[model samples]
Target: MKPVRFWVGLVLVALGVLGILDATGALETGGLLSGWWPASLVGLGIVAMLSQRRMSIGPAAVTVIGLILLAGTLDLAEGGLWWPALLAVAGFAVLAGLRREHSTRTPLVMFGGATTREQSRHLRHTDVSAIFGGSTLDLRQARIDEGATVDAFALFGGVKVLVPRGWRISLGGLPFMGGLEDKTDSTGDLPADAPVLAVNGTAIFGGVEVTNTPEK
Candidate 1:
């Protein structure tokens, strides 16, 4: 997390505490979320910080800070500390996320992780010359070490595989369409022989394509 993000996170947490106290009639309302809201925000901030990469620091803080600012703004938009501070912190975070997202073309070769609640990523295999999402997908672009491949185990985001015109492939699994696989878009050439690879995950809004079963 950026130094600003970390400090913003800290301040948010403090605000949450104060909000809780205020909701319980211990402190002034000062315009903020109900007491419980801060607790939820604190948890989110912590998670974003932990999972955030160098490029994801700003966006990572968005969910938490955005929400907190929204709360404070709603309460104090007309006046008080929240008016300017809310605009500054929340706006800063948004710009940070946008800038990060806009500049993210470095190509992530390996990405994976997890948490209790939610997570996600947007990977395009078409842009990838090599793929190793746990298994191994290699070629000249891959076999010859021509391109880069991302190897991961438990990724939460959507995967977009971009294959050559006639690249053949196979993965072990019963030919059944279901779950996050989004069968309507699953396509891959599995030669007569291959191993079964089971894939189970949700498609928030994207296509899931499989070349085919791994050759036996």
Candidate 2:
């Protein structure tokens, strides 16, 4: 189900209504919503989790971070706790990522641009990271027997993914002050077990786009 945008829109509308009510003196939302802005992060994290078939680190991290901030804001926990917790989580993620094997390791593009094109007949997994730069992953020539997964991270940068029209794309990720654009053709006629490519990651102040546009 394509419920990502639906839920996001619903939340925004609810917030707007609350604001209007507060402005009209119909509600004392200011007192209720004070320091509650971080709930948006928690909601987005939950939405991301629901969108995916399995658990993912990105959404889990987002949720945890949101909870930490909410606790601090509500005076339920020390404000100093968030920093150490964030660092620990980030360290764990980095170490975990290093242990995984991929067809290509195209991580860390800082202040530049990088492109990785994989033509493996049995492609399995790959990852991309763009920080203050841009990155592209072209899997148009790759053949997947069962499925493949791509982990993408874009911070103050952009990522573009090129895939073949024959493959089914499952896009799941979190976008914070950023966007995730899916330009792939529909797979309405594909079989239930058609070769799938699962793309997941986080875009912070950047964008991650998946396109099936044919090469010139």
Give all candidate RMSDs, comma-separated: 13.4, 6.1
Candidate 1 vs. true structure, TM-score: 0.30
lDDT of each: 0.34, 0.73
Question: Which digits, one per residue and each the tens of the lDDT, describe model 2 over residues 13-73?
Answer: 9789999999999987886677787787687667765775434454455566677878777
The segments of candidate 2 whose C-alpha lies over 4 angstroms from its true place after superposition are 79-121, 125-143, 146-157, 162-206, 211-216
lDDT, model 1, position 32: 42
lDDT of each residue in 74-112, candidate 1, tens digit only: 564455655555575666456555654433222222233
C-alpha lDDT (0 to 100) for residue 38 of candidate 1 = 48
TM-score of each: 0.30, 0.56
When summed lDDT is taken over every stretch of 10 residues in candidate 1, the lowest stretch is 113-122
Question: How far out, in Å, is residue 188 in model 1?
Answer: 1.9
lDDT for model 2? 0.73
